[model samples]
Target: MWVDRADWNCCGEPFRIGSQVTWELRRDIDVRWLMEALGSDTAVSVDAFQYHHGDTDVASEQTSGTVARIRAVHWRSAPQTGTVPGSGVLTELNEADRGAPDRGDLTFEGFLVTLKQ
Candidate 1:
């Protein structure tokens, strides 16, 4: 196979930065949904970025510097499973020099806790 480079989405999908939202796992969900529905949370590690995309919010390329942002859900406190000791990354975005789109995965332990709300 070719040794592909660059993350699945590069710098991250575009976004307006300010208009963003986030969610956490509840204790009443199922791991199956986290797996079958959106894609296997196992195919990739929760630590590794997953998928991403973006587009311009303007009618034309009038604003060249106009940039937005994309987000990902990385499980810091992943499962207390066989994973290495202390795998908590804490998911939070910070002000950036123009953040980009990105994707991510969750470890098995994370998968269990994320949806098992």
Candidate 2:
């Protein structure tokens, strides 16, 4: 499931293996040397930063960029959560479900993304 914690959550559309996606950076990221390091057509894995949760330090609009190519696909799975192995499945909690006491430990998903400026 998506990164659902007291700190942040996912608020964007779900992506697929070949989907082009864009997201904001949690902090300043230096990708100036990416093309040189991985070549123009090469796709590299990077983190899809967390969604803002009203924390002034982790705002959603910090840094955003153009859509980037999905170089390859990798799935994140957990046996307990019964997630599809290598599917990278993530869930976004509805506002009402944010702090439900019945909600116990939840699985989280991480993304490796490329950034296009």
Q: Of the candidates shown, which would achieve the greatest lDDT relative to the real structure?
A: 2
Model 2 TM-score, all chains together: 0.33
Instruction: Name the lDDT of candidate 2.
Output: 0.36
Candidate 1 residues lying further than 4 Å off, grouped into runs, are: 1-17, 20-85, 96-117
RMSD, every candidate, angstroms:
13.7, 10.8
Candidate 2 lDDT over 17-63, as tens digits, reads 34444544454334333333333342233333445445566545544
Off by over 4 Å in 2: 1-10, 14-22, 28-48, 58-61, 71-108
- In model 1, the Cα lDDT at residue 15 comes to 35
Query: Can you give the TM-score per candidate against the true fold?
Result: 0.21, 0.33
Clash count, predicted structure 2: 4
Give the range of the ten consecutive residues with the poorest summed lDDT in model 1: 108-117
- Clashes per candidate (backbone, < 3 Å): 22, 4
lDDT of each: 0.27, 0.36
Q: Model 2: how large is the Cα RMSD against the reference?
A: 10.8
| Backbone clash tally (model 1) | 22
- Per-residue lDDT for 6-101 in model 1, tens only? 332244333334534222111222333233323444423222222222233412111122213322323323344323333323223333323323
